[model samples]
Target chain A: MTEWHDAAAADALSDDEVMGLSIAGVPVALFRQEGAFFALHDLCSHGAARLSDGFVENGCVECPLHQGLVDIRSGAPCSAPITEPVRSYPVRVVGDRIEIALNR
Target chain B: MTAMPESEATYVVVGGGQAAAWIARTLRAEGFAGRLVLIGEEPHWPYERPALSKEFLRGTGSVEAITLLGAAQAGEAGIECWLGQRVTAVDRVARVVTTAGGRSVAYDTLFLATGGRARRLPGLDTVPAERVHTLRTLTESERLRGALGGAKHLLVLGGGWIGLEVAATARALGVAVTVVEAAPRLCARTMPPVVSGWLHALHEANGVRVLTGTGVAGVTGTADGIAVTLAGGGRLEADHLLLGIGIEPEVGLAAAMGLALDDGILVDAQGRTSDPRIFAAGDVARHPNAFAGASLRLESWANAQNQAIIAAKAATGGTAVYADIPWFWSDQYGVTVQMLGLPGLGTRAVARGTPEAGSGCWLMLDDTGIVAGAVAVNAARDLRVLRKLLEDGRAPLPDAWTDSATPVQRLPSRPNVGMD
Candidate 1:
């Protein structure tokens, strides 16, 4: 089953900003790059660092703890110190609210 | 100079730490289809060492969690790993390395990432081996973790990063911990006095008995516990003892090969050793560091990975220089402390945010008002921004830089006019 959860307001995050929130008890990071919003698991797959606290650049977020790069759109690890990929969610802006689809 | 055909040549990497692992992975990632061999003394594949003292000791992290390059990953990357095989000798003339198990592997190029081993205390010959411990390998960390489970008290020698991290982890496991350092303050060699004082206070607040300006005169093991005689004519008892003095670079093979050595295997900016065909990285190589303005053997995780990547690229005929600014981080008691650049070059320290509240950073500025270094505690985001600013030789005006009200990202910065 697919469940859609309202993450935040569409304008809550500016360009190149990441916001962390727990949707259905799962930590998710909402990133705004360019003009589109992408969502990925908030926790880093390699270490205990939060991906939301990382620096987003060139469509990837650099893990603040280790500088590992993770693609914000596909949630694939793009650099060393991180081999596994974080889960990505389907995000859509419904009116003024940002909604993320999570598999149950 | 002509480059060898990628598929015809063979590249060998010695050691199984993060550096060696990255070298193997990077060799394959850079489109090298040659025979890649990784030889390591330990049986296990390469894993990150930071969590061994922190999460792994606290029983929260698993071996899989810390495993950086696994067997399957190595296989996928076409890296043939010779685990549990110690490289006994390097025949520079023959272009081959011999293992203790009598296996010889020839290579067109070799990477020496033989990191280091934990420095052992001199006077612990009388103590039983099981009671006195030094954490360097996975097996040692596992043994220490097992011992801590039943231990009542842990006496950690040398209040360095490793010692303090283990102390913090032991405290989290409900074990009474005491740290004794011969230096005047904790992490005195790496951190400034203010940062060291903050760490001392943090440890004391967490119920850790920290003794500075003290040394262990002798150690004796008994049936039930271990006794440590202090240099100041005092004695202390603990269930276990961990020697966290430091690490001695594994320069045995490098020295035998007649490579230049000064504290470690001396390497150029590209990690090339005395011989152009041989390279060294990680804790074993004392390469010229642009940030410190000296040849330094950095033991941090960042340097291990980045330096290995650069060395691997250079070995494969790439022209990348290893000139990254030094960055290191340590997590203790839910607080993350990160150090960037060289703090030793700072003449003035400016505070950003409320450090007492456990969310701030200290910006170290040189005499010319340029940001020389930074120590951030739970403020990685600000440090990230500051790193870029530092790279660009930009500094925020001194007046508004220290104001906690102004956000670090919003702090306006101008190019350093005083510096050329």
Candidate 2:
């Protein structure tokens, strides 16, 4: 069963901006880029650093700790220092609200 | 340059450390279908070395936890690893390497990533004693970890990265630690004065006595413990003494081959040594860095992996240049300190965080107003953003640079006008 949770209001994050959100005690990162919203696990796969604090560039989030890059849409690691991919959440925007499907 | 062999020639890499593993992995990943061989001196697989001083020393993990390229992975990658085999000679002229195991292997391309050995204190016989140690391999770290368990007090003879790290680990283990540095400040060669002061304060706050401007004249074993005699006519005692001074490049095989070497094997930007057929990387290779405008040999883990990849690709007919800005990290007392780029001489250091706060970022800008380098203490996010600005030669607003409330990304990165 899929657990749908409202992580944040869609307008809270501007384009190319990232914010940290807690959905049902799961640390999640919300990223808005190119007028679209995406979500992924906030914790970096390489180290215990928050992905929300990472820099968003070229549709990828470079982990602040160690500079590992993860694709915002696919949660796939696109650079060195990180090999494992983060768990990406399916997101949908409904009436200025961001909904994430936590496949719990 | 030796001609490519008619038969299937093997891509041979000496030294089974991080650099060799990356070289082999990259060769196969880049579609080099030739035979691949890795000659390692250690019996175990290639593992990450930084953890030897951090998590592994703290008893939080085992050797298996830090293994980078295990046997199974090597088999899957079709790499023939000669573990515990030492290469005695590299015949660069004939394109063959002789191993201590009485075997000679010919290679179409060769990578000499013969990293380095820990620099021991001069005139010190570092036998397998419980009281004296120098960490360079897994065996050393394991022994030091075991010694830490029964040790009451520890004396570290250097204030470099390894020494400070081991001091922090010992302090965490409830071992009374004293770090004696010959320099006036901690990490004098690498760190800025502010960062050095910060590390000094960090160690002192955590019960580690940091004695600066003190040199160890001689070390002698006492009846029950080790005694360190200071050059200034003083003595200190400890259950164990560790020497974390520095490393000497393992250039024996390369030097024997008569390849060009000053402090290390000289390599070009493509990681090519003086000989076209042989390439070098990691601590053993001193190559020109475009950023620093000089040749340097970096001993960091990132350089080991990245430079080896470039060398591997170059061996396989790729044009990748190994000129990335150097980056390194050290973990001590729960603080992750990191550095990127070259803080050239004569640059001014500007702190982005409060110096008194003990955790902030320090930026070194060249006289031309170009951001040259950065050192971050627990402010990795800011460092990441600042790294880009440094790479782009952009300068941040002075008011916002030091303000912690202002996000680093929000600071404009357009190159500072008239600074070029």
Candidate 3:
């Protein structure tokens, strides 16, 4: 089952910016890579570095703590330090408001 | 009816380290029925490096744990274990290897697992066997352990992993220690900036003197003790001096054989050197990596095993490529510091948890949007997952670096000598 959860306004983040927040009591990383927006669970399975605190380039995010990289859309690590992928949520924008489905 | 003779395969291994031991084991496990000859300069067998700094130094893990071969075991495997002999040279053209003790051993296939030895500080003259020490070999470590209690001023050279570890141990023993490193930061070659900074703080907090960006001018012994002069025009009077600068590959035999050497015996993806019958692995061999598109020399315990796996398979008819991310670990001030994948600083650093406050992981990112490296402190479980991901072409999360700034995390205090 899929349900809508309120996220943030589309203009809240600048293009290529990343913001971390919590959804459904789960820590999450919100990213704006290229022109797309992505919502992923914040906690890195490998350890404590927040997914939001990682680096982003070429449509992927790298954990700053251990240098493990994850894809913003799929929450998958690209290499090293982090071996596990993070969690991803379904997202869409309604007018100026952006919402994500964390229950999917 | 006339019958022709069939040539029997033979296996020859060089080195007295763990990699050589494991390769020989793998050869037998793969069901190879061939004559095996293992030659080593040391009279003893294989040993583990992890213990060399800890219990082995403390005289707890006996020589048996460090010994690579057992007579009964090798006998059962039908292996010839050569001891107390040095390989004077190798004739690659003739497929023959000779020992200084006057014996010529021929081989169908060869494995050079020749490991590494402690690197000497150039300017510092050799110390009288008693007061000066370096802790790469079990023998030196064991001797140093006994003198640990008597050291009033300990001047340790180098700020790399070995230096930090020894400092931590000396500090734990309540011995005053001063570390001299010429680099701007400790472990400058291997770890990131933040990690080195935290270590500097950790050692200083423990009352150890960590002088970075400083060089040791020279060391001369007087009637009182050894005088350690610094580059910045200072002097350190110490009872004992321990130099842990680094290690160098033991490639004397390889060079004598003229096996197309660079910094080490150069090998291809399959660990095959210029002489096809001769292959090298572990710290002694510089092999090409398809992933990095360059030749690399690896000295970590993990690297040794991984390289040995490749050499063994190739020696047994498997031609797998030798390529994997380099990883290394060290324990300092009770932190299990593990580095996965090689990384250089690229302006992006993410701090998970609080390393300064104690406990967390660090991720260093590069411009390519891939994780160049990941560092974990006191987190081995997570490192495994991260290690696996990197191996599978996966990187960690992409974002800014962070930490739990609100509160400090309390960790289980570590034993003084527990880290490797």
Clashes of each: 0, 0, 39
Better of 2 and 3 by TM-score: 2
User: Candidate 2, residue A4: CA error in Å?
Assistant: 0.6
Each model's lDDT comes to: 0.89, 0.85, 0.73
In order of appearance, the predictions have TM-scores of 0.95, 0.94, 0.73
lDDT of 1 by residue, B94-213 (tens): 999999999999989999999999998776777888898898888989999999999999999999999999999999999999999999999988787778889999999999999999
Q: What is candidate 2's lDDT per residue for B1-420, written digit by digit as tens?
A: 336552366889998898888898888878888788899998879887898998889899778767778888899999999999999987776788899988888887888999999987766663336688898899899899999999999999999999999999999999999999999998887776767888899899999999999987888888877888899998999999899889999999998999999899999998998888888999888999977778889999889888998998888779989878878889888788888776534267788876437578887766777666778887887887776775665768655687777788787555743365
**Could you give the CAPRI-style class of model 3?**
incorrect
Name the best candidate (by lDDT): 1
Range of the 10 consecutive residues with the lowest summed lDDT in candidate 3 chain B: B410-419
Specify the CAPRI tier of model 2.
Answer: medium
DockQ of each: 0.86, 0.69, 0.03
Q: How well is each residue in B193-244 modelled by candidate 3, as lDDT tens digits?
A: 8888888998999999889999877888867568888889989888788888
Ranking by lDDT: 1, 2, 3
Indicate the residue-level lDDT of A27 in model 3. 78
Off by over 4 Å in 2: B1-7, B126-128, B344-347, B366-370, B397-400, B412-420
Native contacts retained, all candidates in order: 0.92, 0.75, 0.00
Off by over 4 Å in 1: A1-3, B1-4, B416-420
Candidate 3 local lDDT, A60-83, one digit each (tens): 776654456788889886643344
